[model samples]
Target: MNKRLLKLAVTSALTVAFAVPAFANPFSDVPAKHWAYDAVNKLAQAGVVTGYEDGTFKGDKTVSRYEMASIVAAAMQKDLNSDQKETVDQLSKEFATELNSMGIKVEAIDKKVDNMVKISGDARVRYGASDSYDNTDFRARVSFDGKINDNLKFNARLTSDNMNYDDEFATKTGIKLDTANVSFDALGLTNTVGRQDLVLGNGFLHDSAMTGIASEIGNLKLFAGHLKDSNEVYGAEYGMKLGAADITADYVKYDTATNDVDVYGANVGIKLTNSVTALGEFYNVDQGNTDANAAAYGLKFNKLGLTALYRDVEDGANSAYSGMHNDIQTLKDEDGYKGLEVRYDRALAKNTTLNLKYQDFEKQDGTEIDGGARTQAAINVKF
Candidate 1:
């Protein structure tokens, strides 16, 4: 009924919300039963955070990158500073685009690491289940990207997760490149290359291909290679944009110990006005000279200042996998991965939002003919 009571109520529910790759932690400051604490109290009072039914803030606990983005954003929301706003906007774009290319959705917090070369990192100390000892991990990065020439620009980023977790840890410590970009204008057309994301066909192959080069000729966008086995698949993905609609195609091949395979596909997407968008695709695989087909479609709506999207793929039966087309398998039609998926995103604030996703794949009988169901919800924020 009252403001204090309202904060108390949601704080209880926020405890159960899944933060991803992060276990539900009761913030250290609030403890399990204490009512008032600095960190939790501020977030709770501002509607930025809450606690569990048990009533704990769990602040001292280690948080995942995705969750941290949300927390940082909540803290800076309602910020009206002009210069700060511009910087945050840039960080949000960069982060979101990076995570999106990985098929993971996150509210980009551009405000945290704007234009100025960023020097930031974190440390995580974990106490495994039923373990008396704590395992600690520390990682850091120093990134710089700015214009070197009037037309040429470059970027450099170095990061390390954990030496202890690496097994290669302590043994090796250095700056590992996480992301870098360069662009050039030669003669007439523009060419861009480096470790980055290529958005085509509404991202059906979103970040499907990692290392690549984007060369545009007139209306065509050509993407090629960086796909192999353990590292990545090296090949080419190409695209052509036409008025509100863009068509892209790619050929990726893999030769594993078990089998030699080829994946080829094409996608077409249309941006219908400012509020609606759609995508369609066709993909095929060639193994042992046998071909299998897969179809995909996606939709996006951004009207009234809200974004909603739906994507579904009807992948044809392969030699045998429930979700795949494994022609190399002994039992034909026994191994392939296929499924129906749906995802929903709603913006709760200018920075914080909610996401809900569901996935169901083709299965057989009692056990899960192949794949069953996947459901998850997340609250994302960006500073």
Candidate 2:
């Protein structure tokens, strides 16, 4: 027997062994009479292989081991008869090394896709009114925190703020990037660089976002940044745990257009009882010419989730502590307003909370300010 004829016989016999029922023809190159036609047709019908888009099978061309591994992977998902399964098993053994490597590659791709990206979001709705005026607002924020590696992390927050009716009954919406920063640990300090939100000295002195670099050491933090569109600022904060009390203090200097101003503040919270806590804070902003000072004290009853707050603005005028219903125009010259605030917080669900607040405002003369009563209610949802 001729060697060529023997090889041809063996190849033909193997093709017949691998053949399946004739299916619809998809490839013009592999005709009904082709030796591997049945096998190719069955694999195509089962979605195991798709030949060239030009409608040709190119059956004579050789396939790389990697390509054959992909075909085997697809075929593994298909239902197979015993003969087909046996043929596939033999091919699997022949290409075992390539298939194993392919499996590892596929698992690696899946791991990268699953572990590298994460997302979370929160929403809030609020309604409040001050004596004769009323307003409502809604907010939503979404955060993305990606772990780039073991040492570095990237973070960003997209916020939608105060989409509501203005004084004229027209709707307005504001969207902004509330936070964008990268954080890392180096030189015995945790460092963050970029635009960020800062809460200093129990939020009595500063609770706003700015752009800068912040570093923390133990219970001390230092920051240098542009301060809320007013001036560039440099600040430091230190916190201490003292028995049943937590104490924090901060000092900041602002370079304003006219001159430099210095700000200093301290906040202390003492747990008097398991369910009762006392809080106190004082803040002072000093210009070269004058000073503005304020103090706030409060008690929090955790058992009932109620908080009572009192604020005394000493200057009554020209105060940097303007958050608690102080008019900058009157705060600069005329007396400022003193106020007592009460808040109640309750959990409504596993990831939802409700808050209610009432505020009473008065003048230094102990007289009630007209339309000085303010009330607010809000709901927060998270997960």
- The number of the candidate with the highest lDDT is 2
Give the Å shift of residue 290 in candidate 2: 1.5
Best by TM-score: 2
Off by over 4 Å in 1: 1-144, 158-176, 187-189, 198-200, 206-212, 228-244, 251-262, 270-276, 304-334, 364-371
TM-score (C-alpha, index-matched) for candidate 1: 0.48
Off by over 4 Å in 2: 1-115, 166-171, 316-335
Pull out the clashing pairs in model 2.
316-336, 318-331
Cα lDDT, model 1, residue 217: 65
What is the alpha-carbon lDDT for the whole of candidate 2? 0.66
